[model samples]
Target: MENPFGAQTDSESGSAKSYALMTARGPQNCIESLHHPRPRAATRAGRSGVQSDYGSSKNLETKTPNSCPRKPTRFLTALSWQYPNEGVIKINTDGCRKGEDGHITARGVLRDSSGQWMRGFAVNLGIGQVLEVELWGIYLGLKIAWDIGCSSAVVLESDSATAVHLLNKNVEHFHPLATMLWGCQDYINKNWVCSIHHVYRECNMVADKVAELSSCLELGLSTFQDPSDSIRSFLSEGLLGVCRP
Candidate 1:
């Protein structure tokens, strides 16, 4: 099957397809954009056949609003109201820009099958790079483990292989953000010693979009100053929107 993270420039799935990764500075590069396809509407057009009208509430018993005063909850930062994370309770984490210069803030979300969200965090990082954002995703997952007092978690994923590999095997931290990353690494090392797996971008939809959405908003949200606010507020405000799985 073709990679969900990318699209085939030539219409054929196997025809010299390209995968695109967003740049820390701004929009994604054309080649990077080619790699991952946006979530689709229900039907073949979505291509994945994973589309549903989550907004439809035929009968909830509670008087439905005559008209949606705001967005129809189609999918804000998540891109889709229906996500792949089910009962598994996968924690999706992402990073975005921080200040005026567009410094990236690392954000994450935790959700279960019933669409219940447990937690979320948005950390503003001084370093602006995809690798760092990916690392932040991993760190946030580990932090969630510590929060829930879990000894180990099975579904730790990241879009960036560089960071995941670094965690898998100790490596030098060349970036300036290593200081911040170390805190997250320490949480995993001290709390959940092992069982961290590296997953592809396709599996990390929630976090990927969380990071993307954080970048889109001008919330001035950061974990460095007030972790509780960053993590807690992110969960309430961000997760309550259009979450998946």
Candidate 2:
């Protein structure tokens, strides 16, 4: 068989050659064993005319040749739940825990139509498991929904599937986050217009970043009056493209 792209014509050859290029995926550090594949490095001549970090092909190749630079995977994250938007209010929640100092925190942020910030808040959860923290974040967000009077909410999404599962299950008793279920149930009982979903960290980008910020004491914690700058990353990644009506 002959390859039309090239002059190779070996019909009787025992082995075949493959030139399809494969790019990396997932987090920046997810790929291992593969060598540090950089893009083709800058030729001295190519670098001479470039004024910006990535103004030319050689400059880009020089910077990240082997890097799998896909767009931020928040769409991949949001798509996991198969959630749809139709005249519904959506909420995203996130939680975090530290291993060394036994510290934990949860932050929940909400928004409505018109790109307006509806609510943002953080709680010093003291010492708790990561799942408990995630559940707390979801619970807190639901409480906010009630306070703000959001009607007919469709999805309550979290980056942690384990926590989300615990949230929408038939638990015999409350974990560290049992009280949150009580609150969530109470809110649903009154409104009965909401549902739960498990969005991937990529989709729940804003919440994950906000939850990670719990460990950054230098950033200083704030309440609904002041959400940590984590949500900015989510918006920049374009997660709200399918936001509800």
Candidate 3:
């Protein structure tokens, strides 16, 4: 069987196929798009076989009533995982879905201020959207942190800016993933001190790699008290303060 987590694959024609990560807009833009009403155009192709009905409003309508257009600023920044403060635990989590088979997986890793692994978990969620799985990762991470008595001070990080934005904002009850979002909010609103932030995927590779292990492991949630051999190097790199561009 092919490795779902592999960065590259061999094609039948003896060629190599590489997968590239998609870069999403910043949290502000994502939040605006989610909350504002925009004109819809024809349905077009989207990632992971999902059909997208959203289209550029510029083509549908020249301008909206009293709308002011501003050019978005772009800049380059490098990202790296930072250790938590004293007596605090940093949690990094990620969720992924295989495009071909539609297998959804979520994983999380918790580390202390010394950059030592506390606990890690991976779950095979069967099938779901990228956003749903992302929320699952956050919820599972928080649950594990609370169970381990580390809820006093915890910092949660996720690569999905949309997921982070949703948690920070007031989500509508009729939203598709409202229940899952509410569960996450319950943990955040607890007596503990938990903060969530959006980080680049490069800073979350350890959790990303752990999630990939679900593709080969049995269905359900798996916990790891020690870092796997596959992700040890990634953990080491973070400890060394290596930043990714």
Top candidate by TM-score: 3
Judge candidate 1 at residue 225 and give its lDDT.
16
Provide the global lDDT of candidate 1 against the true structure. 0.43
lDDT of each candidate versus the true structure: 0.43, 0.48, 0.66
Candidate 1, which segments miss by more than 4 Å at Cα?
1-89, 97-102, 112-115, 152-154, 173-178, 191-194, 216-245
Superposed on all Cα atoms, the candidates' RMSDs to the truth, in angstroms, are: 17.3, 26.1, 15.8
> In terms of lDDT, which candidate is stronger, 2 or 3?
3
The worst-scoring run of ten residues by lDDT in candidate 3 lies at 13-22
lDDT of 1 by residue, 1-245 (tens): 32121212122222112111222423223212222122211122211111112221222233336686564534222222333334344555555555566566666666654445555555444445666566655655666546565454324445555565455433334534444344444554563333344444444555655565454332222222122322344344434443333
Count of steric clashes across candidates, in order = 20, 4, 0
Question: What are the runs in model 2 whose C-alpha is more than 4 Å off?
Answer: 1-86, 113-116, 174-177, 216-222, 225-230, 239-245
Which model scores highest in lDDT?
3
TM-score of each: 0.45, 0.56, 0.69
- Candidate 3 residues 1-245, lDDT tens each? 53333322212111001101111332222223333232222112230111211111121223434554573444445566787789989899999899676778788999999999887776666656789889878978888788778857777888888887777666676677766676677677667677787777877879988877777744455566677567889999889877765
Question: Scored by Cα lDDT, where does model 2 land?
Answer: 0.48
Clashing pairs in 2: 1-11, 38-65, 39-65, 77-203
| Model 1 TM | 0.45
